[model samples]
Structure formats: structure tokens, C-alpha cells
Target chain A: EPEVTQTPSHQVTQMGQEVILRCVPISNHLYFYWYRQILGQKVEFLVSFYNNEISEKSEIFDDQFSVERPDGSNFTLKIRSTKLEDSAMYFCASSEGLAGTYEQYFGPGTRLTVT
Target chain B: ELKVEQNPLFLSMQEGKNYTIYCNYSTTSDRLYWYRQDPGKSLESLFVLLSNGAVKQEGRLMASLDTKARLSTLHITAAVHDLSATYFCAVVNAGNMLTFGGGTRLMVKP
Candidate 1:
């Protein structure tokens, strides 16, 4: 049972700082995604990656956010000039195929705290 | 736009009780998924409903999908404390991205 793995279980940063969350998706997965959950709120989608490029992104994924595979196993999400509202649990998910019928496996998540 | 709606946003039950949570979506997609999240934790995969009339069971929980009706249900039998968590159902459109429901918070007491 291969699982999605995220690093830096907890991250604390000051406002205006740049932060990167890392993930290692399942070995055979082709589609990758990023989502965030504000405390006590429903999880929100950020962006999805396939074919080494962004397939789709939510409005929340603005100029301030970017994602990259960078390497074969690592998927990274970078937030430029973090804000207080950016503090949330960031999750990484990967699936065997593209959207529609694919089932995604989610990572344990990285808790990002901005002060 | 695809919207996943779940009813009974909050549920509280005692041990040995049976309950069902309902999830509805507005679309024609056939792929649906259920996930569980405990407080201060990440989402855990529960069930994947691939098509109409698909039913899968695990332990004390069973999930069924009715694609024609654009609905899914997760039923728990003899619920226990361990089953207490926030359950969410997500609809996967053809794009492969998932639109998750608001979630149903369940509290099972002993």
C-alpha cells in the first residue's frame, strides 16, 4: 500500500515569507493535486497537475501560488508572500489516472502556520 | 459547476445504533468517493463508488452509489466510538478534480 508522503508536518513562518510544501506521491500515480483546509472548514482544492503541467486550478490558486513536480517523485507547492489567511493544513493527493474515474490517495498533510 | 451536498451536517448516536449519511451531487459523473477526517488530522479514504448501483462494505459501514439519482449513501451499523469523525463525499468530474461536500460530523458515544 503506497501512500502519499508530505514533509515538515508543521511549518511556522512570518507574513511576507516564502514557503514550500513538499510531497512524494505514490510511485505509479499520474495525477497530483493540492488542497487546503482552514480550521473547522471544508477542504478546498488548490490545483491539479498532470502531464507535468497544471491541468486546472481554483481561484484560490492565484499568482501567489505555484506547483511543480521538479523531479520524478516530488511535488512541491510554493506560496509567495504568505498571509495570515494562508495558515492552514495543506494536503497532497495522487491518483493512478486522470480525473473523472480516478481515486486519489491523500497525504497526511502539512500544517502551515503564518504569523 | 459541480456541487456536492451532504445532509444532516451533524449526527450524534450511541453505541449499537444504526445511521445513514446522505450525499448528493449535481452532475452526471459516475465517480464518487468518501473520506473520513478526525479532528486535527488528514483525510482518510473510506470508499470509492465507481458507478450506478455500486455497493461496497467494510466492517460496520456500507456505502452505495446511485449514479442515475446522482446520490450516494454511507450507512453505519452498530456504530462505535471509533467511528466518530467528519465524513466527506467528493464528486469527481471528468476533469479528474474532486469537489468535496461540506462533510457530516458524527459523534458516537458509549
Candidate 2:
């Protein structure tokens, strides 16, 4: 089965540095999303994207975060300035249709470690 | 805000045992999804329950959703060591964002 793929399975960056996490969602999926899981914590939604724009975002997705489908296959999440609290496993997910009606497939996740 | 909660955050069972993991959500939703994650691995989709009374089974695992009660359950029958993993239940909200419950970590020993 086709699955979402993410690059840089593990990333380490200095605090205050900019970092971008990349994902390639299933080719045919229509909706894309970003979620983060702090160690031993529940997954938290960051943002949702559709039609080349952000459809929804959580309060945690503040000024530092931005997402873009720079190409037909790549979805990228950039943090302008990283913080220790931003260290988490970031997962990219995609669904074929409305997320409420279709199951979203998750990527292997990129573990971001900021020091 | 939508809140999802899963009970018995950690479960240890002997091989061939049966157990159920319960997920409760604070808001109304028609879509609920169950996922399994191995340690240090990605989330794997297990079941999707789209409506009230929806039930789906795969292998030794079964999932059910009751939209009215805003609850979902994942039951493991005759679980084996391979079934050891963290299980998460996520509910889709009005804006199509998924709010995931804290996962249940299952350890099935031989």
C-alpha cells in the first residue's frame, strides 16, 4: 500500500535555529496534516492543509510555524525559530477525502531534537 | 476544544489473553480511528469507525464506536506478543482536525 513518507527520520538542531521538516504524502490524497507527539504524550494537531492553503491550525501552531506544498509531492513544515519545547516527533498525514469521512495515513515521523 | 482520553495507559497481559481499551471523547463526532504504533515507529492505521454502532475487526483485534456516547473501544482477542504496541484513538472534529487520545501501551508476554 502507498504510504506517506518523511525525510530526515531524526533531526537535531540548535535552539533558535530554523528547521524544516519534509513530507511526501500519498500521491492521490487530498488533505494533508501535521501533528506532533511529545515523548509519552498524546498526539497534538498542528495544522491541516488543502487546496494549497491552510484549512485549520491549532493554538500551538503560532507565528513560528508555516506549512507549504512547495511542489506537487512535497509538503514542508518550517519553524522559524526552534525552542526546546518544540522537540518532538512530527508526523505527516494525508487522507483521500474529507478527514472526517476518510482515514488519514501517517508517515513514519521525524523526530526533532532541539538543544 | 475536543478532548480524547484512553484508560489504562499501560497494560500487561500474558499470551492468549483478552482485553479491551476504552477511548472517550468530550465532543460529538462521527469519525473515530484506531492506530497502533510500535516503539520508535510510525502510527499504523488499524480501524476506522465512521458512525454510531460501527464495528470492524481485523485479525485478533476488533474496534467499535458509539457516536451517541462519544466512545470507542479496541478489543484484543487471544492477543500474542506481536500485538504488543501502543494504541491510539483519534476523533475527527467539525473542522476535520483529529484530536488523538493518549495512547495505551500494551505488553503481551509469552
Tell me the interface RMSD of every candidate, in Å: 1.8, 1.7
User: Residue A26 of candidate 1: its Cα lDDT?
Assistant: 98
lDDT of 1 by residue, B67-95 (tens): 98899999999999999999999988867
Alpha-carbon RMSD of each model: 1.3, 1.1
Query: Can you tell me which runs of candidate 2 are displaced by over 4 Å?
Result: A99-101
Best by lDDT: 2
What is model 1's native contact fraction? 0.66
**A1-115 in candidate 1: lDDT tens per residue?**
7899999899999999999999999999999999999988888899999999999999999999999999899999999999999999999999998745568889999999999
C-alpha TM-scores of all predictions: 0.96, 0.97
Q: CA lDDT of B56 in candidate 1?
A: 96
At residue A26, what lDDT does model 2 achieve?
Answer: 99
What is the docking quality class of candidate 2?
Answer: medium
Please write out the lDDT profile of model 2 over residues B2-101, one tens digit for every residue. Answer: 8999988999999999999999999888889899999888898899899899999999999999988888999999999999999999988977789999
Please give the lDDT score at residue A59 for candidate 2. Answer: 97
